[model samples]
Target: MEPPAPGAGPDRPGPHDGDPGAGRIWLARAALLGGVLVPLVAAGLRGVLWVLLGVAGLALTGAGLWWTLAHTGAVRACGAALAVAAPLTVLGLYATHGMLGPAVASLALVLLAVAAAGRVLSPRSRAGGAAPAPATAPRHPWILMNPHSGGGKVGRFHLVERARAAGARVTVLTGRQDVTALARRAVAEGADLLAVAGGDGTQALVAEVAHENDLPFVVIPAGTRNHFALDLGLDREDPAAALEALTDGVERRVDLGFAGDRVFVNNASFGTYAAVVGNPGYRGAQLRTALHDLPELLTGERTPRLRMRSGHRRAQGLQAVLVSNNPYRYAVGPGRGHRGSLDSGLLGVLCVHVDNTVQAARTAGGRKGGLTRLTGTEVTVDADAATVPVGIDGEHVMLPVPVVCRIVPGALRVRVPRGRGAPRGSRPSADWHRVLHLARRSGPVWHHRPHTTGG
Candidate 1:
């Protein structure tokens, strides 16, 4: 039997397909209430609950500090302080309270029990299923790898040797040559399958060539933030595992976003992000560059005034605009960071037209007070200047005014190893509705239905 598309599956009923019925909603609410209350009641009964809370808070805070340090790299002073203070504070709390140890011990046991319960009650976890190897897999594949990306991930992971073992000719990109030219040459030399181990910028260049030649493309997520890889359900943490696709992979078609002639696998942005990325210093000091440039871009008298039109809606003097391949659910929690389906033939448009810097900061912080968002098949952006700067998948470029962004549905064919699991922290959570359905002993609350092009 033929395997389904990478993520597509049999059609099934969903909440939006039909009304979930009034009774189901009410029952869901009850279950949600119980889930919350039960935890609180248990904590209240234990006198040492305060100690457990303190430990958990410290651990979470420390984690946040580490993440900030890793991403920004300029927060050494604050990170150092937090690193020293957190442990000492925890130690002081433990010394002052004798019962704290017993409380923590009990909490650990409770957590274990809860985790086990969740594992048993949750729906079965699906394995990464295998896809039939593409015919092109037999040919000697050419892989363009960016060693500098993800802090020299290729060298650190010894990816060249692994690719050679998988019957691939690997090319490590140094500063001397152009990536797109090299990719075109490889295709001309009869490369059947093309792959890249780099960030989205390099991925886009290679993908564009592959798409034009009708070659199956493989993505190895070896970048600081592999947004496209995450959306494709590729394992971002394990770049080596991506090679498994060469032997056992399935082909799936996905949409690609275009800004004029340039293609972007992720999203493109104009305004604040574009201006900031254009700065040469952004690569070394992203936080510092953003802090210094944002004010000038937002408040300066020379700030470019942008006008955008999509369908009947028109926006003017926007401080920033982000157009993604598909709409992202900002209301959802962290788990919703990646797109669930890439075959959606629509562009996700977000326009920021703030009155002042404060409003801009609020909007950047994810508050949607002055934000205008919409989805369309195509969007047009015009600016007062003859040319405009754009950040396409984090790479800055200049384009003539009246930038047209559109979605090319199913334009790129991607291959991934069968049964490859979703990226870490990207799986959707079991919300209240799912709990209600499960309580009623019905079928799977969330079904993996095949995504169609039309809305």
Candidate 2:
């Protein structure tokens, strides 16, 4: 069978490309020599050289990790390595010298070097401030901005001027208005592209309308930690550049998650966590409550009795349940916080069996309760009670006890800014660059066209 895309397959060969069998043989031999024979030989020689070697090893590991975030691939590969090596180096030095003086000095120097290099190479902080957004195509695009998104990024970022200047017609929506109605109206009026600037919940609503109308959608990230947009590589700070791509960028058909009658771009969850977020002040007090009242939440009588059945598997009396459309559950590395990829179709189900106080604390990134990973097209969460508070795409929803969710493949079309041109012989990917170029040439929409037909 043909291998999947680079990110699609977990075991695909990456930058460490070589014959796997041969590489393993060499690696095993190297480990044997360095770990067993060399160490034994050095001990027999009764030399003080291990201290210097250990220090050098720690310094090198610290340097690699300190730079990994800048190099995404390296971050994936060696993020855990550096985290482990730094501690081991420190421990070894302490064993030898009984003081962290030399080890601390070396680690600091290496970290400083890494920090300096990061600052020097960071493009976002360059001296020229920020350049004018490059131009794009002349397509007639309509925009819907939520002023409440990401602490009001739309109003703060000058996104409208940039987008209008890049050949898009802009509209801002304030207050509790219906975005779906606005989006559907735009589609009916023959708007070629419709982009929404807001959180994932708002994105899901726009996507539902776009999907129903079979219209192309553009994502202008204006949410706190816009995970989907970031994964798609759209510039969060530059709406003009993203808008230019919509006028001239490449379009990709992405999936959307369907939960009963609702749709979402991310995941959904139930239980105490959902109840917490549904509360008026969940976002502001999540960390605080998670720390203080967790004991009561875990051991209290208020625990909702939930019964979950996904595919053929079943669980009972669950305290908290999280059903994700595309698993964003991932950790930076081993023993790290949970993290996940957004593109994978499988939902990550994390159930917390919080029957006792200790178990509840462990559920909050603690050491007691563990997570479960499953693959299913449809998930059902049922409870004995009548109404249950559901958190869908970071927004609360009031629904009946049982809730069902499934993945809708290729349900939405989104225009994203393509990277630089492809190499010779490779087919062109997203045409973002070309789109931007064309939009720039078309110039801004100086006047609104006269309304005709149904518009």
- How does residue 71 of candidate 2 score in lDDT? 34
Model 1 misplaced regions, further than 4 Å:
1-136, 331-336, 357-367, 421-426, 429-455
Tens digit of lDDT per residue, candidate 2, span 295-317? 34444655466787776678788
Instruction: Report the lDDT of model 2 for residue 341.
Output: 30
Candidate 1 clashing pairs, residues 3+ apart or interchain: 128-419, 128-420, 129-418, 129-419, 130-418
TM-score, cand. 1: 0.68
Superposition TM-score, candidate 2 onto the true structure:
0.62
Q: lDDT tens string, model 1, 321-412?
A: 88888765431335455554576677888887765434433443334546777778888999999988899899999999899999999899
Clashing residue pairs in all predictions, respectively, total 5, 18
RMSD of 1: 9.1
Q: TM per model?
A: 0.68, 0.62
Per-model lDDT:
0.69, 0.57
Q: Once model 2 is optimally superposed onto the true structure by TM-score, how far is the C-alpha of residue 121 displaced, in angstroms?
A: 29
